[model samples]
Target: MWLYAGRRIVLTIPILLGVTIICFALVQIAPGDPIQNLLSPTATAQDAARLRAAYGLDQPLMVQYFIWLGKVCVGNLGMSISDNVPVAGEVLHAFVNTIVIALISVVLAFVVSMIFGVIAAYRTGSLADRLITAVAVFGISVPPFWLGVILVIFFAVDLSWLPATGMGASGSETFSYFRWADFKFAIMPIIALALPPLGIMTRTTRSSIAEILNQDFIQTLRAKGLSEAQVIVHAVVNIMPQAVAMLGLQLGYLIGGSVLVETVFTWPGTGYLLNKAVLTRDIPLLQGTILVLATAFVLINLVVDLAQSLIDPRLKRS
Candidate 1:
């Protein structure tokens, strides 16, 4: 197991490097100058040129990239031209905010999906199963941004049950962790972001459980006079490898999806930070944020792979 883990960690280095290189190259290819955006309309051409030179934007693209890469290696992510803040500090703050929202959504999705999936599988062909499947289909089909807007309209505007947007009320020094106020504010955004994954997981679980139910061992269990509940628990345990694998992948997707979800909801998160960087062409902030997110994605996938091997001895042998 240690050997396998070490192998996975070693493999992640190239993946992260590839991501950094590709994102750096693509950002360079994007039109419009970050310096142009930073300069004031009243500034003369010479003034803009001087500013660009100071920021090293006047340098060759490759030179700028290597310079930035070297700085990143030495633990400096540069400063955000748009925000006038250290890139690392801004991204770290956003990272915390994004992870908090993503974690809640993942837990909510996992519990809801597992429960409904198990119930649907256990009650196959029943009205409850059909209804749950239908709901899952609808959830999967709905767009998160649209869903978020609709939720804001109904829950925040029409009903006035929650604040329309923003992380918290203005002029606040601290945050409310478990207040009704905060829950009302955050619940819709979390649900909107989680719905698709929840639906996907539900479907995956139901299919996995159904397959397990048809296995010869399940029949043997039934023939041995085991109750349906006993058979289901055994079948679920047997089918857990796939479920665990899916959970890991879905968790990654949920984290990635926060970018769009945060934007729609006006939530303060890494996704929103990235969006801000792109809009203003803040290269250092964008590059650093992408690196952090990509690193996280690679690590999560590695952990998931290890989990699958642990759950199934066949995987370990392979």
Candidate 2:
């Protein structure tokens, strides 16, 4: 197990390097000059040149990339052009906000999807199964950003049951999930983020469980006088690897794809930060945010791979 884990970790090095290249390349290819965005309308040509040189934007692409990469290696993500602050600090702050809600959303989706999927699988052609399938389909079909808007309209605007946007009056720094005031702000975004994953995982889980039930091993277990619940426990354990993989993929999706949902809700997260950076053409901020998010997605897959190997040692051989 340790050997397999070591190999996986070693393999991740190249993937991380590739991620950095993609992050840097994407930011560079994006239209508009960060220096132009930074300067005032009346700023002179020399002012533009000086500012560009200062940010090393005047450097050759390869040279700029190396400089940026070198700085990143030492935890310096450079300065945000629009905000005029350290990109690392800004990205870190937004990342924390994003991860907090993302983790909660994924966990909620995982648990609920598992329960719903198992029940639907067991019930098969029954009305309960149909109902659960309908819900899952709805979740899968709906876009999170649109759902977020509807939720905000219904729950926040009409019912006034929850706040529509922002982290809270106190902001992310003092935010606490345990506090209703702050928690209410998260409800819609979490729901928006959770639904698609919940649907996807539900389908995956139901199919996995159903397949396991049809296997000869399941029949053998049943013939051995195992209770239905115990048989289900065995089946669930057998499908855990697939479930973990799906969960990780869903989490990566939520982390990277929440831009729309965050924009709709005006939630203060990396998605929101990315949106702002793009609009302002803040290359440093954009690069830092993408790098962080991409790294997170890669790391999530690594952890998920490790988890699967642990659950099914046969995976290690593969």
Tens digits of per-residue lDDT for model 1 on 147-221?
A: 888988998889988787776763122445577766666788788888988889899888888888888999999
Q: Please give the range of 10 consecutive residues that has the lowest summed lDDT in model 1.
A: 168-177
Top candidate when judged by TM-score against the true structure: 2
What are the clashing pairs of model 2?
Answer: none
Clashes of each: 0, 0
Tens digits of lDDT, candidate 2, 72-167: 999999988887899999999999889888999999999999999999999999998999899999999998899999999999999999999998
TM-score of 2: 0.98
> Residue 73 of candidate 1: its Cα lDDT?
79
